[model samples]
Target chain A: MKQRFLNDTNLLLVFSAAILLMPIWLSPLGAAYPDLLQKFAIYGIFAIGFNILFGLTGYLSFGHAAFLGVGSYAAVWSFKLFTMNVVPAVFFGVIFAGLLAFLIGYISLRRSGIYFSILTLAFAQMSYNLAYSVLTPITNGETGLQLTINDPRWIDSMYITVEEGLPSTNLFGLKMSGYPGFYFCAILLIVCFFISLRIFRSPFGLMLRGIKSNQNRMNYTGLNTKPYMLSAFVISGMFAGLAGSLLAVTDPLAGAERMQWTASGEVVLMTILGGVGTLIGPMLGAGLIKYFENIFSSFNKNLLHEVFSFLPDGVEDVVVQVVSLFVGGGWHLTLGLLFMIVVIFLPGGIVEGFQKFGGVFGYGKNKNSDSSPQNQAAE
Target chain B: MDSILIQILNGLDKGAAYALIALGLTLVFGTLGIVNFAHGAIFMLGAFCAVTFRKLLTLSVKVKDESVTMFAAYKDEPYLKIWFGDTGEAIIDYAVPLSILIAIPFMVLVGYAMERGLIRHFYKRAHADQILVTFGLAIVVQELIKASFGANPIPQAAPDIVAGSANVGLWFGLGESLVYPWWRLIYLCFSGVMIFAVFSFLQFTTYGMVVRAGMRDRETVGLLGINIQRRFTIVFAIAAVVAGTAGVMYTPILPPDYHMGMDFLVLSFVVVVVGGMGSLGGAVTAGFLLGIVQSFASMNEVKSIIPGIDQIIIYLVAVVILLTLPRGLMGRAGVMDD
Candidate 1:
């Protein structure tokens, strides 16, 4: 018990130190900028929550983006009706997404395997199409939901008055944007990580692992699997919701595109790329994909030229042309190729690759203490 | 009543596309047990095949005009027209139909390559891995198309002879106004023939008999010393060809775009599930049923009552069917639902 507690403490300490000092580590990778950093933190939370349901229970959802979009819409609505404070907005975001997840989860969990995936996908696409057209009144159609200056923010109007246009979201008086916003997201991410860790060690999480491994044996042992699966689904949905709320809190806008199936595919890619079921793997995956999205996609021909200026004139032109294909408008091609390679060659993802490399080099843990939970989850 | 008739006509045209794609999907699923998310990408490639054929037929040569400034002011005379006079013009006019000749061979080769190179390796992997890999392939295919053709939708019109609306209302004693596109009717007829041909091929052919036996129990068929694996490969290629032809025929109705495959993929999957996984007949039936339901829901009266019914009717039907029937309308009891 003492050794286990020490291990947990060590893990938490290391994780906290890494996240808190992200500015130091991320700067070298050119992702320490505020917007990208916030994205990393937000998508990390989304992936972590997704991992709980997918990695643990092996229930692959193709509609989790619905909850994320719902959360944003709810948050934006809260900001419109109530105070500009993020607390109420985030609260409503989580609650609304939780309710939506409950409804979708109840109907969808009736089937498993590809059937479940299809059901979730249908629900998500239905939500997306509705949001695009029929629910235009609530979602603002394709224009998206945004805060207006003339609206009756009942509590904000009564308590505080600002003369310089629409007010930004705040915790107390500190603004939720730029460096401060990133730190706020980072702090929340740490809390989320700790909670996920606790769940990983808990009996409830063990039952989820059991369901993933062999639900038949679990059923034969007299365990009701539906409630457990539903709970995980709702919890994960709430995580997506919270991330959505954070996005609105930072930017104060919610678009219908946020709930698109492609967005859902992206999170799946992130979790798979980072190594599913491992506590830190999803966060790593989120950061890597976000880094690619923000940094790699922005590399224009001019930027490429500037970077490769040291090369000979002829070689530089040739290099730039080839490198340009993997970035900018061709970024999706690169991403698709990378994704295919990873799924085919590294099914367990980067974490598995690292472990194997370490083992081959005799740098692995001597006592097999590094027999990661991900390995068990992958089985 | 005329409006209702027109709506039903519209539904059948849309349903034809759905049925063709779903039938192809079910064939592969039944024989190979692979949930091919990339199947829609095959359809997209088919549509592009027609576009390519048109482009090739209309390849223009710049002729200098002495009235202006050399090549700066030139006349674009198509090489085909210059080479063969009216014959070249006629070929360009009939490019969409003629493209079927190109699509079949190209699609067959693609299907064979996919099965032999990538899909055959994934037969023993988990369903999640299969889905991911195939989805990845779908993305790569679409991205390549986007790189080559650009992101905009390329509109292709039917030949001038069949371009106008056919006044079906006159036949029904409802005046001359209730008309439908003639090409859509052609599409519906084409899909019907294709589905019938596929069904007949499977029912009468000895190769198809071995395939059915393999679908029933692969190990038992293998025990009898038949090369079931090779036949399954051929079936995959056949499925690809069917999807490709369906796409080629659909180009006149809906413009070809890089993302069209993804749009149809989700809807087609819903059709497959509602029809019952692995049941070809169920797929065809459900495709038409959902298509009609969608058309009906989009009517003003239905929209006023149900609001977003058109947007969700297919998925709603799928959910209801899956919940109530579990195995779908004609799905085998233990194929995918455990």
Candidate 2:
């Protein structure tokens, strides 16, 4: 018990340290900026929450982005109507998303496998289409929901007067932007991760895992699986809501595009790429994908030229031309190829790849320890 | 009533495209048991085949114009026109239909390559893995198309002879106000022909009989010493050709874009699910049904009543159907429910 406790603490300490020191360590990778850092933290939370439902219970909801979108819209509405303070915004985000998720989860959880995926997808698409068009009065349509200087923030108006420009979303006057915003997101991520880790080690998590493995057997054994599955779905949806609210808190804008099917696909890829069911894998996957998106997409022909300058001019030109096709506007191409390779060669994702490589060097004892998540969960 | 009639007519062409694509999707699901998210990419590739054929046929020579000596500008005089005059022009005019000749052979090769190289390897993998890999392939195919053709939609004109709208309303005594596009009617007929050909081929041939048996139970058929794998490859190829032809025919209606396949992918999957996962007839029926429902939902009367019913009617229908039926319209009891 003592050894296990130490290992658990060690893992938490290592993870916290890595995230807290991201700005310092990630400078070499040119991804230390506040916006990208915030995205990493936010998407990490999204992926972690997604992993809880998908990795833990094996229910893949393709419409999780709907919860995220609902959260953002709710947050922005809160900011517009109630206050610039993020607390109320977050509450609204979580509550609205939870409500939407409960409704979708109630209907969608009726079926499993691809049926579940399609139902969730349909609900999300309906939400997206509604948000994009008919719900324009609430969502602000294609222009998106934005805060304005002239608008009344009821709570803020009661407390204090505002200036000419729109007030930034804040946590009791601590501005939720730049490094401060990233740290706030990082702190929340750590808390969420801790919650996720505890869930993974809990009896409830084991029950969920059982549902994932063989729900029919569990049902035949007289266990009601629906409530457990619904709980998992709602919890994950709330996490998505939290992430969505955090996005609005940082940027103070909510757009319909945030709930697109492609956005849902992105989270799914992140979870799969990081290692499903494993605690830290999804976060790493989120960071890698975000890094590629922000950094790689910015790679222009000129940047490629500078990177390939070491080679002869003729070779450099050819190399840049070839490489340029997979960067800048073509970064998605690289992502697609990388994802295919991972699914084909590394189904268990980067974590499994690392374990395999470590195993090659005779790290058998370490491999046997805590690598089989099922064993740990079972215990 | 006239509007309703026109709407049905309008739905038929789009319905034809949906049915054709869904038919292809169901064939793979039934025979090979692959989800094949990249099936729509094959459709897009077919549209591009037409685009490429036109581009190839219309290869232009630079004719110097003495009118612009400041830069000595040259005008592109199509090589076909330069070589054969009216005959070349006529050939270029017919590029969209003529591309079918190339689309069939090319799509077959692509099918064979995909099955032999990538898909067969995934025969034993989980459904999730299959979905992910195929989705990845879909993305790659779209990206490659974007890289080559640029992201903009390429317009493929139907043969000029059939470019105008037909007097279908007059034929039906509905008046001169209800004209439909000749190209669309042609597309409807073309899809009908394609669907018939596929059905006849599958319904009659000994090869298709073996395929049917394999679909029912692959191991049992294999026990009988039939080369089911080879037959499955041919079926995949047939799917590719059907989707390709559907795309080729759709060019005049909806301009061919790199992401066109992706837009269809979701809808086709919905069609497949609603029809029944592995039911070919169910797929065809659901495709047309959903297409018609979508068209009807888009009417101003319906929009005013429900406000954006058109955007979600198909999904709403799918959800209702899946929830109520569990196995879809013609889905077997144990097919993919788990």
Candidates 1 onward: DockQ, in order: 0.53, 0.57
Strongest candidate by DockQ: 2
List, residue by residue over A317-349, the lDDT tens digit for candidate 2. Answer: 999999998999999999999999988988877
lDDT of 1 at A353: 74
Worst 10 residues of 1 chain A by lDDT: A370-379
Relative to the true interface, what fraction of contacts does candidate 1 keep?
0.60
Q: lDDT of each structure?
A: 0.88, 0.89
Kindly report, for each predicted structure in the order presented, the TM-score of its chain A compared with the true chain A: 0.94, 0.95
**Model 1 regions more than 4 Å off:** A1-6, A307-319, A363-379, B64-73, B171-175
Per-residue lDDT value at A213 in model 2: 75
> Positional deviation of A340 in candidate 2, in angstroms?
0.3
DockQ, computed on Cα atoms, for candidate 1? 0.53
List, residue by residue over A270-292, the lDDT tens digit for candidate 1: 98888777788789889988888
Q: Judged by TM-score, which candidate is best?
A: 2
Task: Count clashing pairs, candidate 1.
Answer: 0
Clashing pairs in 1: none
